[model samples]
Target: MDKLLKILSENSAYTTAQLALMLNEPEDYIKAQIKEYEDSGVIRGYQAMVNWDSVPDAGVMAIIELKVTPQKEKGFDEIAEKVMMFDEVSSVYLMAGGYDLALVVKGDTIQDVSAFVAKKLSALEGIVSTATHFMLKRYKEGSVALVDVEEPTDGREMIV
Candidate 1:
Protein backbone atom coordinates (compact mmCIF):
# COMPACT_ATOMS: atom_id res chain seq x y z
CA MET A 1 0.00 0.00 0.00
CA ASP A 2 1.07 3.56 -0.51
CA LYS A 3 2.46 5.37 2.54
CA LEU A 4 -0.20 8.05 2.31
CA LEU A 5 -2.96 5.46 2.18
CA LYS A 6 -1.45 3.51 5.08
CA ILE A 7 -1.34 6.63 7.23
CA LEU A 8 -4.86 7.61 6.26
CA SER A 9 -6.14 4.12 7.02
CA GLU A 10 -4.58 4.16 10.49
CA ASN A 11 -5.88 7.65 11.24
CA SER A 12 -8.07 9.65 8.92
CA ALA A 13 -8.28 12.64 11.25
CA TYR A 14 -5.00 14.09 10.05
CA THR A 15 -5.30 17.35 8.16
CA THR A 16 -3.83 17.67 4.68
CA ALA A 17 -1.04 19.91 6.00
CA GLN A 18 -0.24 17.42 8.75
CA LEU A 19 -0.15 14.55 6.29
CA ALA A 20 2.01 16.54 3.92
CA LEU A 21 4.42 17.35 6.75
CA MET A 22 4.59 13.72 7.84
CA LEU A 23 5.15 12.49 4.31
CA ASN A 24 7.58 15.35 3.48
CA GLU A 25 5.48 16.45 0.52
CA PRO A 26 3.82 19.69 -0.47
CA GLU A 27 0.27 20.27 0.78
CA ASP A 28 -1.06 20.75 -2.76
CA TYR A 29 0.34 17.37 -3.84
CA ILE A 30 -1.21 15.67 -0.81
CA LYS A 31 -4.58 17.31 -1.48
CA ALA A 32 -4.46 16.26 -5.14
CA GLN A 33 -3.64 12.66 -4.24
CA ILE A 34 -6.49 12.51 -1.71
CA LYS A 35 -8.89 14.02 -4.25
CA GLU A 36 -7.83 11.48 -6.85
CA TYR A 37 -8.27 8.63 -4.37
CA GLU A 38 -11.75 9.80 -3.46
CA ASP A 39 -12.76 10.34 -7.11
CA SER A 40 -11.44 6.89 -8.09
CA GLY A 41 -13.27 5.28 -5.14
CA VAL A 42 -10.01 4.11 -3.60
CA ILE A 43 -10.91 6.16 -0.55
CA ARG A 44 -14.40 4.96 0.22
CA GLY A 45 -15.31 6.88 3.36
CA TYR A 46 -13.91 7.93 6.71
CA GLN A 47 -15.23 6.44 9.91
CA ALA A 48 -14.68 6.62 13.63
CA MET A 49 -14.53 3.37 15.59
CA VAL A 50 -16.67 4.02 18.64
CA ASN A 51 -16.76 1.95 21.83
CA TRP A 52 -20.47 1.24 21.90
CA ASP A 53 -20.25 -0.24 25.39
CA SER A 54 -19.64 3.24 26.76
CA VAL A 55 -22.92 4.48 25.37
CA PRO A 56 -26.22 3.90 27.15
CA ASP A 57 -28.69 1.55 25.49
CA ALA A 58 -26.16 0.45 22.96
CA GLY A 59 -27.47 -2.21 20.61
CA VAL A 60 -26.25 -5.80 20.38
CA MET A 61 -24.20 -7.05 17.46
CA ALA A 62 -23.96 -10.50 15.91
CA ILE A 63 -22.23 -12.36 13.10
CA ILE A 64 -24.34 -14.75 11.06
CA GLU A 65 -22.76 -17.49 8.98
CA LEU A 66 -25.01 -18.42 6.08
CA LYS A 67 -25.02 -21.33 3.69
CA VAL A 68 -26.80 -20.55 0.44
CA THR A 69 -27.39 -22.01 -2.97
CA PRO A 70 -26.10 -19.53 -5.50
CA GLN A 71 -28.46 -18.14 -8.13
CA LYS A 72 -27.66 -19.38 -11.63
CA GLU A 73 -25.62 -16.94 -13.77
CA LYS A 74 -25.44 -14.34 -10.97
CA GLY A 75 -23.41 -16.58 -8.60
CA PHE A 76 -23.34 -14.94 -5.12
CA ASP A 77 -23.53 -11.32 -6.24
CA GLU A 78 -27.30 -11.13 -6.40
CA ILE A 79 -27.77 -12.78 -3.02
CA ALA A 80 -25.09 -10.62 -1.44
CA GLU A 81 -26.79 -7.48 -2.79
CA LYS A 82 -30.16 -8.51 -1.42
CA VAL A 83 -28.69 -9.29 2.01
CA MET A 84 -26.95 -5.92 2.22
CA MET A 85 -30.19 -4.04 1.59
CA PHE A 86 -31.53 -4.84 5.05
CA ASP A 87 -31.31 -1.91 7.47
CA GLU A 88 -29.98 -4.07 10.31
CA VAL A 89 -27.08 -5.42 8.24
CA SER A 90 -23.77 -3.65 8.73
CA SER A 91 -21.54 -5.82 6.59
CA VAL A 92 -21.65 -8.83 4.28
CA TYR A 93 -18.73 -10.94 3.20
CA LEU A 94 -18.33 -13.94 0.88
CA MET A 95 -16.40 -16.68 2.60
CA ALA A 96 -14.33 -19.67 1.48
CA GLY A 97 -14.93 -21.96 4.45
CA GLY A 98 -18.00 -23.79 5.71
CA TYR A 99 -20.34 -20.89 4.98
CA ASP A 100 -21.14 -19.05 1.79
CA LEU A 101 -21.70 -15.62 3.36
CA ALA A 102 -20.90 -13.87 6.66
CA LEU A 103 -23.22 -11.07 7.77
CA VAL A 104 -22.68 -8.59 10.59
CA VAL A 105 -25.90 -7.24 12.01
CA LYS A 106 -26.95 -5.00 14.87
CA GLY A 107 -30.19 -4.82 16.81
CA ASP A 108 -31.67 -3.48 20.04
CA THR A 109 -31.49 -6.86 21.84
CA ILE A 110 -30.52 -10.48 21.44
CA GLN A 111 -34.13 -11.38 20.79
CA ASP A 112 -34.32 -8.68 18.14
CA VAL A 113 -31.24 -10.04 16.42
CA SER A 114 -32.65 -13.58 16.59
CA ALA A 115 -35.93 -12.38 15.14
CA PHE A 116 -34.10 -10.68 12.29
CA VAL A 117 -32.17 -13.84 11.50
CA ALA A 118 -35.25 -16.03 11.73
CA LYS A 119 -37.71 -13.82 9.88
CA LYS A 120 -35.58 -11.70 7.55
CA LEU A 121 -32.38 -13.57 6.81
CA SER A 122 -33.62 -17.14 6.80
CA ALA A 123 -36.67 -16.20 4.79
CA LEU A 124 -34.54 -15.04 1.89
CA GLU A 125 -34.54 -17.31 -1.13
CA GLY A 126 -31.55 -19.65 -1.66
CA ILE A 127 -30.60 -19.51 2.02
CA VAL A 128 -29.99 -23.07 3.22
CA SER A 129 -28.92 -22.52 6.86
CA THR A 130 -27.60 -19.90 9.26
CA ALA A 131 -25.56 -19.89 12.45
CA THR A 132 -25.60 -16.71 14.48
CA HIS A 133 -22.99 -15.68 17.05
CA PHE A 134 -23.72 -12.76 19.36
CA MET A 135 -20.83 -10.57 20.32
CA LEU A 136 -20.20 -10.61 24.07
CA LYS A 137 -17.42 -8.07 24.07
CA ARG A 138 -15.29 -6.18 21.64
CA TYR A 139 -11.62 -6.14 22.63
CA LYS A 140 -10.57 -4.46 19.41
CA GLU A 141 -12.33 -3.02 16.40
CA GLY A 142 -10.49 -1.94 13.30
CA SER A 143 -7.30 -0.22 14.59
CA VAL A 144 -8.81 0.87 17.93
CA ALA A 145 -8.57 -1.01 21.23
CA LEU A 146 -11.60 -1.05 23.50
CA VAL A 147 -9.71 -2.15 26.60
CA ASP A 148 -8.16 0.51 28.84
CA VAL A 149 -5.24 -0.49 31.06
CA GLU A 150 -4.49 1.49 34.18
CA GLU A 151 -1.04 2.85 34.96
CA PRO A 152 1.22 0.51 36.99
CA THR A 153 0.72 1.00 40.72
CA ASP A 154 4.32 -0.09 41.42
CA GLY A 155 5.68 2.92 39.45
CA ARG A 156 7.31 0.68 36.86
CA GLU A 157 5.33 0.61 33.64
CA MET A 158 5.37 -2.75 31.91
CA ILE A 159 6.26 -2.69 28.26
CA VAL A 160 5.59 -5.70 26.12
Candidate 2:
Protein backbone atom coordinates (compact mmCIF):
# COMPACT_ATOMS: atom_id res chain seq x y z
CA MET A 1 0.00 0.00 0.00
CA ASP A 2 1.16 3.55 -0.63
CA LYS A 3 2.38 5.58 2.37
CA LEU A 4 0.01 8.36 1.39
CA LEU A 5 -2.98 5.99 1.53
CA LYS A 6 -1.79 4.46 4.79
CA ILE A 7 -1.52 7.90 6.41
CA LEU A 8 -4.91 8.96 5.05
CA SER A 9 -6.54 5.77 6.34
CA GLU A 10 -5.16 6.45 9.81
CA ASN A 11 -6.13 10.12 9.84
CA SER A 12 -7.89 11.71 6.86
CA ALA A 13 -8.04 15.03 8.70
CA TYR A 14 -4.37 15.70 7.80
CA THR A 15 -4.06 18.51 5.26
CA THR A 16 -2.09 18.21 2.01
CA ALA A 17 0.70 20.39 3.47
CA GLN A 18 0.98 18.13 6.53
CA LEU A 19 0.92 15.01 4.37
CA ALA A 20 3.57 16.41 2.01
CA LEU A 21 5.78 17.33 5.01
CA MET A 22 5.46 13.83 6.45
CA LEU A 23 6.10 12.12 3.12
CA ASN A 24 8.97 14.49 2.24
CA GLU A 25 7.28 15.38 -1.05
CA PRO A 26 6.22 18.61 -2.72
CA GLU A 27 2.73 19.90 -1.88
CA ASP A 28 1.81 19.93 -5.58
CA TYR A 29 2.75 16.26 -5.88
CA ILE A 30 0.68 15.37 -2.83
CA LYS A 31 -2.34 17.26 -4.16
CA ALA A 32 -2.06 15.64 -7.59
CA GLN A 33 -1.66 12.15 -6.10
CA ILE A 34 -4.73 12.60 -3.88
CA LYS A 35 -6.70 13.96 -6.82
CA GLU A 36 -5.78 10.96 -8.95
CA TYR A 37 -6.69 8.55 -6.15
CA GLU A 38 -10.10 10.19 -5.71
CA ASP A 39 -10.71 10.32 -9.46
CA SER A 40 -9.86 6.63 -9.79
CA GLY A 41 -12.11 5.73 -6.81
CA VAL A 42 -9.18 4.41 -4.79
CA ILE A 43 -10.03 6.87 -2.05
CA ARG A 44 -13.76 6.28 -1.57
CA GLY A 45 -14.60 8.74 1.21
CA TYR A 46 -13.66 9.86 4.73
CA GLN A 47 -15.62 9.65 7.95
CA ALA A 48 -14.96 9.94 11.67
CA MET A 49 -15.36 6.75 13.73
CA VAL A 50 -17.57 7.99 16.53
CA ASN A 51 -17.80 6.31 19.94
CA TRP A 52 -21.54 5.71 19.88
CA ASP A 53 -21.48 4.13 23.35
CA SER A 54 -20.66 7.54 24.83
CA VAL A 55 -23.87 8.98 23.43
CA PRO A 56 -27.14 8.51 25.33
CA ASP A 57 -29.70 6.35 23.51
CA ALA A 58 -27.40 6.01 20.57
CA GLY A 59 -29.30 2.77 19.76
CA VAL A 60 -28.46 -0.93 19.56
CA MET A 61 -26.27 -2.68 17.04
CA ALA A 62 -26.50 -6.29 15.89
CA ILE A 63 -24.64 -8.60 13.51
CA ILE A 64 -27.00 -10.67 11.40
CA GLU A 65 -25.73 -13.79 9.70
CA LEU A 66 -27.89 -14.82 6.77
CA LYS A 67 -28.04 -18.08 4.89
CA VAL A 68 -29.54 -17.65 1.44
CA THR A 69 -29.97 -19.66 -1.72
CA PRO A 70 -27.87 -18.03 -4.41
CA GLN A 71 -29.62 -17.27 -7.66
CA LYS A 72 -28.72 -19.26 -10.79
CA GLU A 73 -27.08 -16.40 -12.66
CA LYS A 74 -26.64 -13.64 -10.08
CA GLY A 75 -25.34 -15.83 -7.21
CA PHE A 76 -25.29 -13.72 -3.99
CA ASP A 77 -25.16 -10.32 -5.65
CA GLU A 78 -28.91 -10.10 -6.13
CA ILE A 79 -29.74 -10.90 -2.50
CA ALA A 80 -26.88 -8.76 -1.23
CA GLU A 81 -28.25 -5.76 -3.09
CA LYS A 82 -31.75 -6.31 -1.70
CA VAL A 83 -30.47 -6.59 1.89
CA MET A 84 -28.39 -3.42 1.67
CA MET A 85 -31.44 -1.35 0.68
CA PHE A 86 -32.87 -1.47 4.19
CA ASP A 87 -32.22 1.59 6.35
CA GLU A 88 -31.33 -0.50 9.41
CA VAL A 89 -28.48 -2.21 7.61
CA SER A 90 -25.09 -0.56 7.99
CA SER A 91 -22.97 -3.18 6.24
CA VAL A 92 -23.24 -6.45 4.37
CA TYR A 93 -20.46 -8.92 3.68
CA LEU A 94 -20.31 -12.28 1.88
CA MET A 95 -18.83 -14.93 4.14
CA ALA A 96 -16.87 -18.10 3.36
CA GLY A 97 -18.14 -20.39 6.10
CA GLY A 98 -21.21 -21.12 8.24
CA TYR A 99 -23.30 -18.37 6.63
CA ASP A 100 -23.65 -16.67 3.29
CA LEU A 101 -23.91 -13.04 4.36
CA ALA A 102 -23.01 -11.07 7.48
CA LEU A 103 -24.86 -7.83 8.10
CA VAL A 104 -24.39 -5.01 10.59
CA VAL A 105 -27.70 -3.48 11.64
CA LYS A 106 -28.76 -0.80 14.11
CA GLY A 107 -32.03 -0.30 15.94
CA ASP A 108 -33.42 1.17 19.12
CA THR A 109 -33.67 -2.13 21.00
CA ILE A 110 -33.31 -5.88 20.69
CA GLN A 111 -37.03 -6.07 19.97
CA ASP A 112 -36.65 -3.51 17.24
CA VAL A 113 -33.85 -5.46 15.63
CA SER A 114 -35.75 -8.71 15.99
CA ALA A 115 -38.84 -7.14 14.46
CA PHE A 116 -36.77 -5.94 11.50
CA VAL A 117 -35.38 -9.43 10.94
CA ALA A 118 -38.73 -11.14 11.36
CA LYS A 119 -40.69 -8.71 9.25
CA LYS A 120 -38.25 -7.25 6.75
CA LEU A 121 -35.13 -9.36 6.31
CA SER A 122 -36.67 -12.77 6.77
CA ALA A 123 -39.48 -11.90 4.43
CA LEU A 124 -37.09 -11.56 1.53
CA GLU A 125 -37.02 -14.41 -0.97
CA GLY A 126 -34.20 -17.00 -1.05
CA ILE A 127 -33.38 -16.50 2.62
CA VAL A 128 -32.84 -19.88 4.29
CA SER A 129 -31.99 -18.80 7.86
CA THR A 130 -30.89 -15.82 9.91
CA ALA A 131 -28.96 -15.38 13.17
CA THR A 132 -28.68 -12.05 14.92
CA HIS A 133 -26.16 -11.19 17.64
CA PHE A 134 -26.51 -8.00 19.61
CA MET A 135 -23.34 -6.14 20.45
CA LEU A 136 -22.72 -5.85 24.20
CA LYS A 137 -19.45 -3.95 24.25
CA ARG A 138 -16.91 -2.46 21.87
CA TYR A 139 -13.30 -2.66 23.04
CA LYS A 140 -11.90 -1.55 19.74
CA GLU A 141 -13.26 -0.22 16.46
CA GLY A 142 -11.40 0.38 13.17
CA SER A 143 -8.07 -0.27 15.02
CA VAL A 144 -8.85 2.51 17.50
CA ALA A 145 -9.00 1.45 21.17
CA LEU A 146 -12.18 2.40 23.03
CA VAL A 147 -11.07 1.42 26.52
CA ASP A 148 -8.39 2.91 28.78
CA VAL A 149 -4.91 1.38 28.56
CA GLU A 150 -3.83 -0.42 31.74
CA GLU A 151 -0.34 -0.65 33.24
CA PRO A 152 1.74 -3.71 32.37
CA THR A 153 1.46 -6.54 34.89
CA ASP A 154 4.54 -7.71 36.78
CA GLY A 155 5.77 -11.30 36.28
CA ARG A 156 5.59 -12.01 40.03
CA GLU A 157 2.40 -13.52 41.45
CA MET A 158 1.08 -13.18 45.01
CA ILE A 159 1.55 -16.21 47.32
CA VAL A 160 -1.95 -15.81 48.76
- Cα lDDT, model 2, residue 100: 99
Stretches of candidate 2 off by over 4 Å are 151-160
Candidate 1: stretches off by over 4 Å: 150-160
Q: For candidate 2, write residues 1-160 as lDDT tens digits.
A: 8999999998899999999999999999999999999999999998898888888998999999999999999999999999999999999999999999999999998899999999999999999999989999877888887766674678789877
Estimate the TM-score for candidate 2: 0.89
* Candidate 1: tens digits of C-alpha lDDT, residues 1-160: 7999999999999999999999999999999999999999999999988999888899999999999999999999999999999999999999998899999999999999999999999999999999999999888888688877563478767878
Clashes found in each candidate (C-alpha, N, C closer than 3 A): 0, 0
- Model 2, CA-based lDDT: 0.94
lDDT of 1: 0.94
